[model samples]
Target chain A: MIELHRVSKVYSVGPVKVPALREVSFRIGKGEFVVLTGASGAGKTTLLRLLYRDDLPSEGDVEVLGYGLVQMRRSQVAAFRRSIGVVFQDAKLLPVRTVYENVAFVLRVLGTPRRDITARAFDALRAVGLSARAQAYPAQLSQGEAQRAALARAIVRRPPLLLADEPTGNLDEAMAGEIVDVLKDIGAGGTTIVLATHQARLAVALRRRTLTLEGGRIVKDEG
Target chain B: MLGFLVGEALRDLRRAGRVAVSAVVLITLSLAALGGFWLVSSNLGHAVAKWRDRVRIVVYLKREPPGGDVAALLERVRVMPGVAGVVFIGKADALRALKQVLGKDAGVVDQLPVNPLPASLEVTPSAAAVTPEGARELLARLAVLPEADDVAGSADWVERFSHWQRLLTTIGLGVGFVLAAASILTVTTATTLILHARRHETEIMRLVGASEWTIRLPVLLQGMMQGLAGAILALGALVVTHSVVAPRLEPLVSLTLGLSQLVFFTPVGVVALLGAGTLLGGLGGWLARAAREP
Candidate 1:
């Protein structure tokens, strides 16, 4: 579950106060696949960051998985992050690790048993169609493969909620379609997904609830 | 998890390469400097104890007195508060001892027209009176004796040597402090380098819900390992140096200080040196963790 009421984010650069999100409010039920569409600088990433408690809203409340982000203690925030998977535009895989290790890293952080970790990581990679590339390194992967590896890493822990920020921003149309299909398969497995993207066509093709943002405010919500 | 933490730490050290090596070298230098001074101080203390046990004061008389007068003076010297024992060495006996000391040059001493050495009472001081202050007080009393013209004792040299030892210890402490600081900073620099190199890895770890300690423990272990390696190396260096130099210096040490041989660190000393190295490294890790990210 996710909830935000009248949330606003402001970034102060020098003497200027630049608003990234303005009193944006939204709710998504469990196991929903939701697309967040916005132009560049339209608060999609900011909203996702707020949901994960990466950055707290300047004003208003953000509730994710039953914890209030605005007032959560740092320890609580860390605990809260474990229940959710987040993907940045950059795949952010450790260059030194193989894809299997990268995905296993999430389970390892959770102190999962070594045997369980192998099983879970392989399963996650299989879901993303990356089990064959498990031995490959991040540097050796194509843009699509890297994104898939990042996806496998996120879902390996089987988080209740998944927030992806432009998971296909750098991919070709064909590769992007494949990533969307993989995401759809993940959502079908009942993990709530909130995917942010600047591509309206991707949002339309997914046939999910789409929330469009412009100048820091949500302007449309339709399926 | 313990295995993972330790493995990660070793891997980090390997990744650290030159910076880690620098840290180890710095630690070795610090511990070696400290250990070297410890050895010096220990040997000096042995010398001091040997000399203190043999402390003697000589009251040189103007001339040998008559039989009754000599008996009275010897009795008076024996009754002094700090006099452990007294032996009267007459002029003829002093000359004989001088000839024995001169060894191959005994003929030169005999060529003199008459014996020039004075008759003296060799006063062996009590344990308490062997100290510089106590010896000085005893000398003052002996100097006032009617039969005595001069009172000579080894107290001044003992006092000066003790002072020199203190000075050396103080200097050693000051140098050890500076070197220790440099070693800690070197470890900090190396840990910081590892932190920077693995910043991305750290962020990923945090995202995957790693505890703060889980992320930090490896870095701390790496620092400690560097320190430990350095201490072992320093101990090895000290052993080699002592072996190579102790034999050459044994004669001089024996001749001057009455010590048969110079020795390396004791078992306790070795443990302390190693422990200090480990502590310095841990301190560096703590400092690195405490510093804010720029």
Candidate 2:
């Protein structure tokens, strides 16, 4: 579903050049559950960001869901974004909007029909087992509930690709397992999932492809 | 999308009700500055026009008519810039005009052994001819004539009218400068506030494939609304004040010129004020978005 060819990212902060990813080439087929693992600056987030076009590769080409991301205009970036569901580690919900509204934000931005938006938002909430808390505020939800709400928001559009950056990084073991289960259920439904994690045991049960990085280069690829 | 923007704007206004009120108050005050000066300028124009219509300039011929020079002199003064048209009131015509004005006192005019008044060149200049500056120039040129006497007219009347116009002109310019400054300040504040409220949302919206106008229209619309509301509020207060006080002032100055004569902005004026106010609001939003958009 996503591919990178000789992609490299360089960040110029002050006069110094910091290289995040260097000549990385990889691909994950459709419906695959992949964990990208690395130490602090091993370019895991940079790879994820490149896939989303949040940050472009400084060199070579990157493709996401068949779109030639290098040639994609800024105007078309949002359309590319809509093709994927992204669950952030932070669960960045608008504090002023309600739980349902947070999930509905993407649809509203897309100018989806009002009735469709409400139905999809409700269904997404139900899928995440949060329909009862649909009207509640972010402040009212526990960490697990908030992450669940974030999941609902990410999947509300039924996007083909799901990218979660540290989906369970902030949760306890039980909560982490819950998030993993939710993500797995999504992957089972044919959405290609690429989750970024450093945990040793989290990606073991899934038995899917794993790409391990070290020193800005992929060191291990296991299936 | 419009509904969403309007809803968001209203919600923002509600959440930051104080800021919205401050925006309106600032905008209203700015408009009041413009409206008040406009009213004053309009009234001044009317007063000048009224004074101009009734006023006439008198050009007196020299004491020695140099035999046949009387008609030529009359012709010269008749063609002067401020001179609308001229009437050659010969000695006999002058006596007749005096008799008419004097009415029953016409007998006293006939008692005079000779016509003491000069065979004056009665020049009726346009209202534009009634200014101190214009009149001064006309008199200076007229006096240089060999047949001329010391030129004179209602200097006080011209002076008074011109004085008011100059004062009003200064105030109009000063008010205009103030209004422009206020517009920029208001637009900057409004646009910045709009952007700040939706910075993250805007980015996400863009990332999610929203168009430029889809994001910007709401901000511009909000600005337009702010301007409209402010102008309306200020004008409403002014109208109410006029209704209450103009009637009372009517007894004092019979020739009072005010909003009563205006018919309350003549629709076009109202539209312009509201349109301008709304534009100010929208412009603020546009500027904010535009600055970051490129």
Candidate 3:
């Protein structure tokens, strides 16, 4: 679950003020698949970032999974992060680690038991249809395959919340459709999914509860 | 859990082997610097101990006691403190020894036909009077004696040698400081590189819900490993250096300098050196992690 009440985020670059979110108010319910749509500089990324406690809101309050984002300590951030899966626009897999290790990286970071990390990592790889290529490096995989690996890493912990920032930005149209379909399957399996994007065609196809943003303010919230 | 920590550490080391190597190099340089200081101080101590075996003081004899009453004069020299096994070396013996050293140079021997060398009493000082300054002060007391010409042994040469040794020690300290500073800088730079290369990996780990402790343990272990490896290398270098140099200096000044008695690291000493290396490496890693804003 995600909630924001009159939240605003502003950035100051040498006294030149830039606002990313202007008193935004929204709520994303548990098990709901939501698509956040906006053009560049529309504050979509800032909203998603607030969910994981990455970027704190400048005004008002934001809460995710019942924890106040602004109030959470650094130690608490780790626990919060462990409860959600995130897919950044870049995939951001460790270049030195193999695909399996990258997925296992999160589990290991959480201090998961060795036996469980290996078993779970294998299962997650299989879920992404990457079982055969688990040992491959990120550089060795196709763009779609790497994205799928990233997807496996996100869901490996089985967090109730999943956020993807422009997950299909670098993929072909067909690949984007497939990625969306995969996310739909995850949402069906009871994971709350919040996907952010700029492409109207990709957004239209998801056919989920949608929130549209223009400039720094939300213009529409439609189911 | 220990294995898991070690595994994580090894993975980080393997991933960033070059950075790890650089850190180790820094650790080793520091170890070597401190080790060198210990080696010099200990070697000097050993040499001084050996010199103590031949510790002696020279007391010039009175003018043969005009009455030829040699008994009282020699007796007085014997009663003085630290007169261990005093032996009288008359002018005749002194002349013979001097001739042997200078080689029978005719003109020089003719010029000293009257035998300018004085009859002297060689007194072995107590171990308490082993320091050059100690010997000099005692000799000065002996010289003012109305009966004697001048005290000779354990004089200027000892003081000069000690001064040179102290100068060397000061230089050694300066060198050690430079080496330590260089090492700290090197370790800091290397750690920065390690952090940089893994920045993305760190971001990924954050995404996956890994705890900070889990992510940090490996980096700590890697730093500790680098330090240990560097220390071990330095130890090997010292051992090899001692082994090679000890033999060459044996016959040259073994008696006076006692180079053979120059002992290298004992087990405890080696451990101390290794521990120092580990601490520096571990601390460097800790600083790097602590300074990270992420």
Q: Write the per-residue lDDT of candidate 2 for residues B1-294, one digit (tens) a residue.
A: 667767766655554455556667777777777766676566666666666665665667666465487677777776767777766667777878889999988899878998898866666666666777776776676667676565666445746865777788778668756775676566557667767877767765665556666677766666667767887887887678667765676554445532234323557877777776776666665676677665
Off by over 4 Å in 1: B57-130, B138-154, B292-294
Give me the runs in candidate 2 sitting further than 4 Å from their true place. Answer: B59-123, B126-163, B179-183, B186-194, B251-264, B286-294
- The deviation in Å at residue B21 for candidate 2 is 2.8
Consecutive 10-residue window with the lowest summed lDDT within model 2 chain A: A199-208
- Candidate 2 TM-score for chain A: 0.96
User: Which lDDT tens digits does candidate 3 get at residues B1-294?
Assistant: 567677867766776667677767766776777687778767776665556767777777755444365666667666766555567778878888887788857357657648877787787766656567667666776787777777778735654665666777777778766765666555656666777777786777666656777678767776777778888988888888889986776676567685655678889999988887777767777777888855
lDDT winner, 1 or 2: 1
Q: What lDDT tens digits, residue by residue, belong to model 1 across residues A77-172?
A: 668888999888889999989999999877776678877988999999999999999999999999999999999999988899999999999999
Per-candidate TM equals: 0.84, 0.81, 0.78
- The most accurate candidate by TM-score is 1
True-vs-predicted CA distance for residue B235, candidate 2, Å: 1.7
Worst 10 residues of 3 chain A by lDDT: A105-114
lDDT of 2 at B141: 66
Candidate 1 docks at the CAPRI level of acceptable
Candidate 2, A1-223: lDDT as tens digits = 8889998899999999999888899988988889888776888889998888888999989888899999999878777888988877888777778899988987886788887999999999988889999899999998888999999988998999988998788999899988888888888899999999877587676677889988778988998
Cα lDDT tens digits, model 3, A1-223, are 7998999999999989899999899999899999999997898898889888888888989889889888888778877887888897788887878999988877777778888998999988887788899999999998888898999999999989999999998999988877887888888899999999998788888888899988879899987
